[model samples]
Target: MKLNMVLDNKKTILVLALVLLSFIGIGSLLPEELTLQRWVAAFFAANALVAMALTFVLSTRLEILETIFRGLDRVYKAHRWAGMWSVFSIFMHWWLVPQSETPRDESSLMEIGSDTGEWATWLLLALVVISFMRILPYHLWRWSHRLMGLVFFVSVFHYLFAVRPFQLFSPAGIAMNVTAIVGLAAWWYYAFGKSTSKHHLAKVQNVKKENGVVSFEAKPLQGRPTWNAGQFAFISVLHHEKIAKEPHPFTIASSQHQGVARFSVAGLGDYTKTLYDHLSNGDMVRLDMPYGRFKLNRSSSPQIWMGSGIGITPFVAWLQELNYTGALTSKSCPNVVLYYLVKNAEAAIFAEELQQLTENLPSVTLKIVYSEEGRITPERIADDLNGNVDNAELYFCGNPEVRKAMQEGLESLGMPKNNTHYELFDFRGAI
Candidate 1:
């Protein structure tokens, strides 16, 4: 991986560091004569506690976390990893720590804590397994996943009242308490506050279906949520009370200056297919706005943009923003070339609009690439750049496999990896 990609995962590194520090802090309070298995098991328990707390924190969708993690998408990615690590840590802690057979001088609270831990272990394991099973229906999986907050609550109770080595005021103890409270608070906000406070009601308008995509404009019933170009939002249609209230993420296809949000949905999955069939004009929808960091960077270097399939939505927004701001007239504006990659001309969404936008904006050059004829490889990009690839910055939003291929190919052709930025569309690990 490139240095930039490594830096993108800095949040995960920070979490791992916390795990180490916590383990050491707790170890300081342990008896010196304790066996290696006992110490390791204790460390794993601490690890699980820390990871679990953070997993909850990441799900809250707090603005500060978005800034720290670079984007909400990255935050969700970290959330997924943290949850996985928590389960793994729990298993290690369970296996390595032997159960006591004889009755001891344990208090009622400690005994209750031990029982809670055992029950939480099975529940956590089952939920984690269910999350990974894509075969399960999405509605069923989502409903099942909501019970995780309860599991974390139980786990924290176990951590608190259990017979532990560290004192409440000590480093490990303080960390656990702080994290537990923060995690629970975050979970509360996600479970309750998100639907009530974060989402805004919008009336759907100008619904159009063309080329297997449904495009619609959503006018907010109240104040509009401000968003930059190339960001995405989660929206759920208010259908006949039977449809799942779960919102699906889609890229905003209109400039923020438009004052009304727009989305182009392609029927790729079951929920989306249902949405395509049911969504109509004047329907009330709930929108959770403005999530993503796929905006254009402040660089004077020539730019190359590639959008494949539905990924073209973000680039369309960028173009609309440029037109709105009159940035195309500026002499200092960087030269831009956008390649719309599709299987064929029929697959290209907003083809006429994109061409007109490029024509109006002198700084931008548009190229429509059909996969039926040719591939948009690094060599082809270099040719388009007139072999001036050294100083050009590349931006791509599309299929993950295509992004990986282009990244490797570009690096091999002497292009700086840091010059390339992309949005990872897959949020399967996240709720």
Candidate 2:
């Protein structure tokens, strides 16, 4: 499945190639230690360095970078994998080929650098574990995760100080330093740059609570940021409740030209529940606007959209935008069948709005899949679409577990893996 995804995404393929080549190039510059174990250690260290560096490359938010990955979702996926790979490589480097014992006459600076490197490895290992273990409280995971910058800084210092004189000036050292610098820059931008730039000053115009969700109607304070149908933004409300200062990515649930964008906040975590408690119509909010690649207009293929619970937000945006974007009657608009799975009719929050939106569009159909009657299955989706699954594009915005099951089931029923697209709303993915 991973191989198929990489093959399907040309950008991922290029990134994978570049990382491998860099490792090889860096390894070539290192002097032969004449010992096999030492060579293995050098290889793993080079890999660890390159992997962490690539993690920085994946984490940054640049238009060209997003296009290369096809979306921020893919970039996060790549970042998570690269980070884990680095940790794994570090483990191998530590255990299989132990670091050489320091000389008794080693300088104090060298000793401190060595100690810092050791500490950094431990810190990185803990941080990576917390990132993947979503069971940890988000507040705990978030703040603990930021310590990774310190790790990168220390690791670079260690490399520069602890390595042999010959290697200190080698291509490997230069390459590693370049990567470390990039990683630091990425961290700095993530910590300070992004919030200050691309921020759309906005104020809450209204807030509505419905079916365990709080929907906000926010009016942009300055010129409203131009947006496409399926993008998301990191929203930070000023004078907010606990965890609200930390931005959360929310899909724009209304049309961009509507003068106000809607974000339906589900009470899934501390930030969200607190958002419901404290968010008011006149509250000030900041938006880092227009992110993600879960777009629909480019494809004219018969499209299948799947949404469950709050995952319906992006689809709502698309449905709302279609009328004004000319997609309502465009020849390029594919035949669309949206499946919004929920527990029951009562949980189908947008049932009324969706009905109204689709009333005018003959090409679009909305199906409410109430699991109370029966859970949606691959066979059901195939039959629902009249077996036109072949070559049709499937877009899903929902939880990763459900998306995995759906993808697997669809693939078993003869749907191409590459035919499906999804946006993981997992905000932990933001950086």
Candidate 3:
């Protein structure tokens, strides 16, 4: 199996296991005088800090922000596991370090039981509970989620004031604290403060249902940035301000026109269902700036765009973008093949537009797969590949399971790793 395949399957579990092994190794090597538990406690504290950051990034649904935040997720995930191990290490440290031997200036067990520690422990426990039990009511979980920042803050202070080595004398400890503070502030700004209504809202000029998907014609409010095809924006209707702020990322369904942008949203989640029910033409709503790195323009090779369900939204935008720029007319665009998989014929929104686009652009080809009608097995894809699969650049936007399966299957057919690209839609973590 490919490395990406392994990462797709065991990313979280692998991180946790590695952190556990590292903690064990460090604890065994440490001298009796310097217990490993204290070090572990400090490690947990750092991990918690990063986890809090991950929560913020996940909440925003900003694709550009997520691109950066994914790196942070890796760090936070490792930190989380390490931090849990550290908690055990710290417990051991407290157990091993005799009361009489503890420095007089160091915080006593009584201090650990004080108001600050009590609040910190409660908040941390809440975070742990919510992270594990995501099925908890969304609103209730959201209300408790805000407490993570406070927990992180208290934990940092607790580390500095309650721990002895982290005093002004320890440069490494001081640096870690400072880094944590800066990271927390930066994440907070990106998640909340930096976002503005001016760049976020788009006026819905029109709504049309071609097949089953509803496409909204939107013009960003003054000062909002323009977007390219294959890019997506987070959108929320105005009435639910809080939920609106929690934007759901959707691909711009319409091609970029002179003054307006378009987004095609399938009624999937609660927010989307509400949008379909209540939203109307001429309504104004908030939309986060467009963000995503997937673009056909960037590559010179023949392209294979694979979309599942509403995931076809980006390719629609890609075709529109090319058409608007006259690339399609000039025949300058590279050969493109769109493999759109939907549940049924009714779900194939923009089917007419897709057919028209392929007709206009001689280089473009269209393929539709209906899973409800018939299964699309790996052998089928291989049989269909013939000799063309080797050089085709593949891109996917859909659920993780489907994406992983498609990726693995395509790789097995000799497609290179570099040629495959996929987008992550659903956000995870505290936010």
Candidate 4:
């Protein structure tokens, strides 16, 4: 992959901030003895504070952040990593920072801040543990996760009044203060000011369960939210108590012009299986939308698209979009091949629709690969391209292991790493 692709905007920003903080922390926290160890400990403390602040900001799901990170998925992924780093930094800060043997006089505010810092440490640890516990129900996990903002709020208080090496007016102190305050504001906005602002009230319709895939349409009770074809939305079953109310992301399987949102969900986990069993027509739902950056590249280069199992959802939307816009019949339509991988023909959801769509669009080809036969190897794809792998842009959405293998295989076949694109589908660790 390209260096720019590997170091995304979110990561670049955080890394630069940490580097600056390291300089500031080491320079300002100079000690008479054990200078190196003390400076390192202070830098970790600074890192923990900045990382915790970033965690709160990323959790807000602001549209500008989604744009900066290129997708909400990327933002949430960054949030998870930042949070884990913060917890790690907190432990390092505690372990390395020297403890004084004699007691010193301190104000009540500093004492409170000191005590609260200890509480915040354990609370943050507990929340991070809960985030990793995938076995927990979504609702329980979500509620427990909300306490992170509370912990961050307390940590900021500790940063303010706790005994630090610099004054509040110092550059390091000012920057940390500003960042933490912004993060606190973001947390406030997410928790109180704009909790349900993006949600569209919708009524479920055309519900159908076929071959382990639950397909449905949600017609907006109010104005419909606009989105591109390959993006996804988070949906919550409002009236069903048996189903977890936490919103779950699913690819939009309809064209942008379609007034109603459509989804095809596979029973990949317990919540999804229960949702499939319980969801019905006329069921009220809250749809939070337009999340991913998985849209088709409009370049003139021939494109190779791979989607495994339920990953085919976005391609369905793309076909619907092309057909709806009459782009499939246009002379400018680029040559395209879609490889849909599934266990077998029975598990290939929307296979007939994909075939019919491709038939109409002479420029587009649909190839279904069954597990019984074999996987779609890079060699097969190269032959299909007639030894023209370099000119084709590859897009994939599926099992992470499969993606890794295909990415390496394609690179070995002379495909430019930058020509490939994909979205990390997992969003389970967002806090």
Tens digits of lDDT, candidate 1, 1-431: 24545776686578568757766775675556668888788778878887887887888877777877777877888889889989998889878877888796555888898778888899998898888876578767777778888888898888888767567777667877887888788788767766455678999999988777888999999986888999888888776464567777899998988888999988888877776777788889888877888885535567888888888888898888777667545434457889899999889877888998777678788999999998889998888878878777778888878888887887788777677787665565644
**How close is every model to the real structure, measured as TM-score?**
0.90, 0.89, 0.76, 0.89
Per-residue accuracy of model 4 over 18-83 as CA lDDT, tens digit each:
757764664564443446777777677778887877877888887888777777877888788888
- Residue pairs with colliding backbones in model 2 are none
Give a tens-digit lDDT track for model 2, residues 312-417. Answer: 9898888877766664445444579888888898888888888888887778888998889998888888887788777666789877677778888878887876
Tell me the TM-score of model 3.
Answer: 0.76
lDDT value, residue 267 of candidate 3: 74
In candidate 4, how many Å is residue 272 off? 0.8
Candidate lDDT scores, in order, read 0.80, 0.76, 0.61, 0.80
Which is the leading candidate under TM-score? Answer: 1
lDDT of 1: 0.80
Worst lDDT 10-window in candidate 4? 25-34
User: By the TM-score metric, which is better: model 2 or model 3?
Assistant: 2
What's the true lDDT of residue 183 in model 2?
A: 81
lDDT, model 1, position 77: 86
lDDT of 3 by residue, 1-431 (tens): 24544554475565457646744543343334545655554444444444444444444434443444333234344334533543443334334433445445335653663335446666566676675568665545555656666665665565555544344435545545565676567556653575564256668877876554577777766664677677776676676532344556677776655356777777777767667666678777777656665665534566677788888878887887777666535536667767788877777765777888777666677888888888665556656555566766677787668878877877788777756676565334412
What does the lDDT come to for candidate 4? 0.80
